[model samples]
Target: MNIVETQNLKKFFQSKKGTVKAVNGVSLNVIKGETLGIVGESGCGKTTLGRTILKLIKPTSGNIFFDEKHLFDLKLNPRKAKDILDNDGIDPKLRKSFEKNKYGLSADASVSKKGPNSWRIDDDRSTYLVKGEENSMKVYSVKDITDIDDKEMRKHRKKMNIVFQDPVSALNPQMTVYDHLNRPLVIHNMVSSEDEKLRKMVDILNTMGLKAEHLIRYPHELSGGQKQRVCIARALCLEPDFLVLDEPTSALDVSVQSKILKLLDRAKDKFDVSYMFISHNINLVRAISDRLGVMYLGKLVEIGETSDVFQNPKHPYTKGLFKSVPQPDPDKRVKAPLTGEVPSPVNPPKGCAFSPRCPHSKAVCERENPDLIEAYGRKIACHIFGKENF
Candidate 1:
């Protein structure tokens, strides 16, 4: 079963010069209880996609399905844009008319007009209402968590949590480890009494290989490894069904990294959690992921079982990424993988974004974008994969 899925998801940002396509038409899934590792260079929208899925950053347009329920459906509507301009300035009578006629006011769905050109979800709505369109927002037919009130969204947020890459910044310097570990319990009302909270906190700390003494110390007093373990413990405090782990071990020593990875591996099996693991370290990703997705210039170019992808990479970009991984022996030296700078996201090419950097770029690769096609027990997007090209 799929715990998370996306369809044609896109996130764009408007700039003085043009629009930047940070995450364009990305569609993928996270299977239940498996870690999906996303590997890509910096600025490829890997992080943006992660943040967008969690609703930390609203996507410009897309459908996000979580646990078989659509969580968000955002579209643009110009007609209802005026009412949201200045909530106070709109004429009461005129606003009512616009809300009813111009915008096909559905049964109970809301369409908040923003600025003059776009109609976004009512920011006033409890951050999660899903199933919204320009004409008529679908009301009860589809269960969208976004449509639920704030209290309900909080409940869903607890089901899914994110552990950021920077544990130092993610932790509070003023709060002690005990405070850090117990906050989730307090917020979620997980435990009835102080004793239960402390007991639960201590148990979690022990599982993460920390002593009760460490709980009283502040974030600064702990070593890098300890801080990361605390972050992991905090994320699991609620026992989330899905976790977004953003390079959790990149900042630690190799020894510490290995221990943290082991802890995460055990936690996943013990807690039955699904992970969307994002990292640039191919070797680490290879070791930890059940499946891997290769990303480039705001698009997923290839994805498959970790072993299959590493052994038989098909997409040129995927091939380059694998080739870039360092070899341990001096006798097995190789050249740099691929050459060419990543294109500017503000004005990506009309064709495949990797065309300029791809050695196998045919004329079609420069003129027409290719859809993700399945082959070699995986999905790949590249003109070279077409039967005619081969």
Candidate 2:
């Protein structure tokens, strides 16, 4: 089953010069039990796309379905009731009394001296009115899930959680590690009492390779790796089915990065958590992700299984990214790096977004956009991959 799906998702931001296409016509599906890695350089809209899927920012246009349901649709129904008194037809004053009692109307307003006003009478007179009988009405439109009744959304939030980039800034400076982990559990009612909460917190800390003593320490006291672990623990407290790991190790030391990656791998199996691991580290993403998506300037240029993508990258941009990673072996020579910086998202190049930097650029590449086509079990968006060019 597909747990999440976004179709033609687009998000545009108005700027002084022009509209910036932060996420432009992007679509992807995440299966129930697989981690889908979104790898790209910084400012490629990876984080924006993730947030858009979660409805943190409303899409300018497109559809997002979670488990085959339109997450944004909300409907409400409202009604008011009034009583009929006596055979001469309900006295206006008495009708007002009934309306007040049934609908909690203001006590001071005098009932207008009129028979069966359009607002009061139902053509079918069968509905009964009794004092204190419940007459309920919905007072508001059903809002987007995020803006709707927060108490209700909190129930569903347990299924999805995010561990943002920058652990130091993400964690509260004043909050103890224990308080950070326990807050979600208590808010979500994961544990019944303080005792169970403490137990769970300790277990989570242990699983993250932290001792009980670490719980009392504040964010500033912990190292980068330790702080990221706390963030992970906090996400785990919900027992979420999906997690968005936004560059969870980017700020850590090289040694600490490996340890954190290994910890994440172990935790995935232990918790059965599926991740949308967003990162700029190609090797780290290749090591952990089952599939790889190469995004450039808010668009995915290529996406395929990790092995195939690394071995035979179809997109020029993907090839550039792979070639740029330094080879450790002294015997092998380094390849030439990709030329030019990424183009401004506000004014992306016409036709192919990467045409300006693509070495194989042809006249047609600058005039016509390429669709993401499927071949060899992979999807690629490049004119060269088309049959005519081949």
- Which residue window of length 10 is worst by lDDT in model 2? 70-79
lDDT of 2 by residue, 46-120 (tens): 999888777767788865545432111111111222332223354455444445544333333222211221121
All candidates: TM-score: 0.79, 0.77
Judging by lDDT against the true structure, name the best candidate: 1
lDDT against the true structure, each candidate: 0.77, 0.73
lDDT for model 1: 0.77
Instruction: Note the clash tally of each candidate.
Output: 4, 0
Local accuracy of candidate 1 as per-residue lDDT tens digits, 1-390: 568777668899888989889999887879889999999998899999898887777788876657753332223243343434324443444335435543333334344442223233332322222233446432111224423455666778888889898899999999999888778888888999989888888888888888888888999999999999999999998989889999899999999999999989998988899999999998899999999999998999998999988988888888887887787678766677778778899988779999888888889998999987767777888888734347
